[model samples]
Target: MRGRTVVEFHGEIDIATTRQSDQHLDAATARSAPSVLVDLRGVTFIDSAGLGPVCRAWRRAVDRGGDLTLLCTDTRMLTILRLTGVTPAIAVTGS
Candidate 1:
């Protein structure tokens, strides 16, 4: 929370939320900030479809030479991230 540029994905971010998430992800990329923190604290569930937005956002940030980080991931979410080998890519902390 706080001042972090948090993107809280509640449910699945499939075709439904893809447009909105893309907007946020694009904003995160366009900003000339040093870093962008996408807090997933409020997210209760996710799937590969949901992960698409995350990857898109991360790629956006990287394109702008900025860093992307996520926090407040639950066990299931953590497993997904770990299994996908993205645990090392995003700076995950304080789950």
Candidate 2:
């Protein structure tokens, strides 16, 4: 069976919710080389504090030889990722 997991996040993502977000990402990516999809379509806002978990999840998936895709259509969020150079390290799909 192909192991794939999807994590959906909503509302604003910041320091107040990083830990919770990280927990969700960690659980989904913990499986062996899982194909993880992070659905950020519901996220209305994100800051550097929020980006930390995304980066960490990406690194974890890469280190485990897995694949991770980010789903989002927020121009602001995309801009932030681009400005931070995180766009190069992760795969993002407009949703």
Q: Tens digits of per-residue lDDT for model 1 on 1-73?
A: 2244666556555667777878887776677653667777777766676778888778777777677888854
Q: What is the lDDT of residue 82 in candidate 1?
A: 89
> lDDT of candidate 2 vs native?
0.89
Off by over 4 Å in 2: none
How much lDDT does each candidate structure score?
0.73, 0.89
lDDT for 10 in candidate 1 is 64
Number of the top candidate by lDDT? 2
Question: Per-prediction TM-score, please?
Answer: 0.80, 0.93
Report clashes for each candidate as comma-separated counts: 0, 0
